[model samples]
Target: MNKAENIIVGISIGDLNGIGGEIVLKTFEDERILDFCTPVIFASIKSMSFLKTHFKSTINFHSINSINQVASGKVNVFNCWKEPVNIDFGKEDTKIGEFAIKSLASVTKALKNGDVDVLVTAPINKHNIQSEEFNFPGHTDYLAQELEGESLMFMVTDTLRVGLLTDHVPVKDISKHITSELIEKKINTVYNSLLKDFKIGRPKIAVLGINPHTGDSGVIGTEDDDVLRPTLKKIKDTGKLVYGPYAADSFFGSNNYKNFDAIIASYHDQGLIPFKTLSFGQGVNYTAGLNKVRTSPDHGTAYEIAGKGEADENSFKEALYTAIQIFKNRCDYEEITSNQLKKAPRIERKQRPN
Candidate 1:
């Protein structure tokens, strides 16, 4: 598909009562997003009306019933829910949880059906949305199941990209999940994605150790020595520029992260703490290893300042830009790979004999 032929981005409105709707309306206020792609939000008409009234944004919203109704150069919205419900700005309700899940499901289906090119999600409240119906931990797991792929969550800024081995796990249980196979898989996924999606050829990756001082050669812990070390060796054997099990505490301080295209952490906080510290309000959470592109602002729903017109739209804006860039990069990478494969046999014959 041509770049200007209108790329459709399916957006899942996070929590109806939180800043999701506000940011959705605020981010689209710029005509730039429409310049790159057509953004279609799966939300309620009532929710959009509430955000326009609350945020005082002058952006126009065109609600449609189906994906085919989407129009280029305008903000198209798919009304997942039509009924009006009382919104307690900054408060959580079970009804809002249901609405958020419904939006997610609709967008996910659209993406799977090739109706949309990418999916950009707003932040959802995990605590308030925990129930049998919404059984997954968060969007990552939900998307993993729906897309039927092994997904890795990565936080990205312009300079650094960090991926977690275990996201949303208890601090104590993190070590249990850090197996050699899992680490190898995460590394391969990160490596392939960098080459395919980000267009980074021969990308260098840093792997963070689970313990302090990289186990200090077993002085602090054994997992870094036993688990991470072997995994790094296996990845390196494949002729990939992968390094480390670097001491988690000192990796960020020594500017070691700058040496690599991305860092793989043992757990969520290990990676996120440093990433957020570096790009808190500007970071984008990108789901790597999926067939379709998906991203969200790294920050969560800030209910404390909801409806106050105090929310920062920088992260959301970055998320939108990142998605578009990755989509373009993927197209370029595919073209390059396809051409190389077509010429491979000729190059092989030239090397085979005199």
Candidate 2:
């Protein structure tokens, strides 16, 4: 395969002790995956080898010191750590957590340096991965801080796309954060993402309400009516096809979301609950509005099923494909728009014919 044609996918080995390594091994086990993009795993070669041996995986990968050594049609791994730490599968070890951060930081550097076209992150344990160097709730915030922009935690699939107003925040604090300004910001992010990343020219967006039954005409809660409604109106006034304060409970049941290009939830569970319910094993968690492309499986570190060879790789694989597709879509959009600008309008010459 020509290096020029391959999309280099940078993968961060999420928790070394979790199913991150197992799923990565399974995803690349089939060589056909290399047909679309080249995969670069940012982790210790030692740890990967240990997992491969334990899992009895037939997957073959090349270890490299830098992404510049990546080869098309091959699974290339950039060694983030040299030390051979004990492979404690399904256990929460602090050392493993530290290396996970190292791997993420390493691949993130490559993403910033333009060495990789996109990133597909494995799941990480939020608690264990916490440290002085990595102090975020999850991948969304960490990437948002590193990439610098409005980061909307977007869960997507072939069937549905859902975005969150607040990610990894506590339930009690959710309402305080659901202000008009915040709603406007996140809704705008979702709209732009649909247009650029998903390539929807005029995305029809549905914004979910914060309270049950959309505040029941202000009896249940007033945020939906006072905050979300006014904010959505402002968004629609700007010529965007945005609507909402829709009741989250009935939105999915009524199949109303089918009419919209994307749905925005006022909180984490509000949007993701329905999305994960419908597309749990196939959903891709895409971080939209970032400076670069980043995606991950909707599931987390399944410690109970980590080393059992029972962890499904469908979601992880979808994440990889989604990142590549979004990158391609953005490129195609830029070309289409740029070419349209280059094409001048036709000039009329009627009198000259006589």
Candidate 3:
């Protein structure tokens, strides 16, 4: 783990109408959260003030006009918007959507400039946020556009990690996007991320079939045999530890996922269904293959329960801790790899039967 020198984590408050602010306040109530890193929230004081009164949580809010005012162990608030927000809890408003996007843009800029170590985003309403400025399906696509990296969304729990090949896409269009090149890229991203970010050497990976019973020898669908099998073989030929085209139904049923480091699903639901079923309210949604670390609670905005003080902060807490752990692991792996490269020639000579 990287030594704690006040890791600054930039947090974007999601749709204020939802429970984003409530959960954020609840999660930080524990002073232990400040021990590992400083959390800077990109939100307006008005939104946070609403949460304080609604949730009745006594959290110190230090408003900052700029990132330069951030301090460790302090809940530094960067006021992204100057206007007052009248949030109707559990209601959908386009103004909240615009507010959410503003917060996102602010934190993303900080992340790109290295002012923040990791980004922990709260849930945003997709339909509400569909404006001229925010046209992406969700945060994953937005981050992909901003950072220009292969943004792969994965759900993380203490027990399992599942990545999606096609996220936030229609079920009918899933097969059209599942090309061999895309599959290989996603696998390579997962493989390299596990090695570099998770400190896993030669991580085992599992790929799920697009059809039932892995196409049942071409009886059900040709996608598994034609697209997935060939891609899996190619990945295997590269001396990487990968196994797949497993029947999606039985894969999660027989506990086969326990053997692999990560599983790549054909689409969003294929991966998210099993993952959420197993780790609901506790899973952390992580965006891998980015230049920086980004994680969010696996669940949605939960508009039904917003501002009722009913939102669980477990997933948010997990997301924060997971981001910190991945950051530390990545830093350590880089150091170890650098040292190994420096001594590789000498070690190779000693092992050559001198």
lDDT of 3 by residue, 224-267 (tens): 88998988998899999999888899899899999999999989
CA lDDT of 167 in candidate 2?
Answer: 81
Point out the worst 10-residue segment of candidate 3 by lDDT: 345-354
Give the higher-lDDT candidate: 1 or 3. 3
- Where does candidate 1 clash, by residue pair? none
- Total backbone clashes of candidate 1, pairs 3 or more residues apart or in separate chains: 0
Compose the digit string of candidate 2's lDDT tens values, residues 1-354.
Answer: 112357999999999778998899999999998998899999877888888899999978798996778888888989988988776778988888888889899999999888998999999988888988788898888888889689989999987999998988899999998888888888888888888888887889888888999999889988877888888888799999888778788899999999999998888888888998998999999999987899999999999887888989999999999998889888887788778988969789678664
Give the root-mean-square deviation of each candidate in angstroms. Answer: 3.0, 4.2, 3.6
**Candidate 3 runs further than 4 Å off:** 1-4, 346-354
Q: How does each model score on lDDT?
A: 0.87, 0.88, 0.90
What residue runs in model 2 are displaced by over 4 Å at the alpha carbon? 1-4, 344-354
Q: After superposition, how far is residue 110 of candidate 3 from its true place, in Å?
A: 0.3
lDDT of 1: 0.87
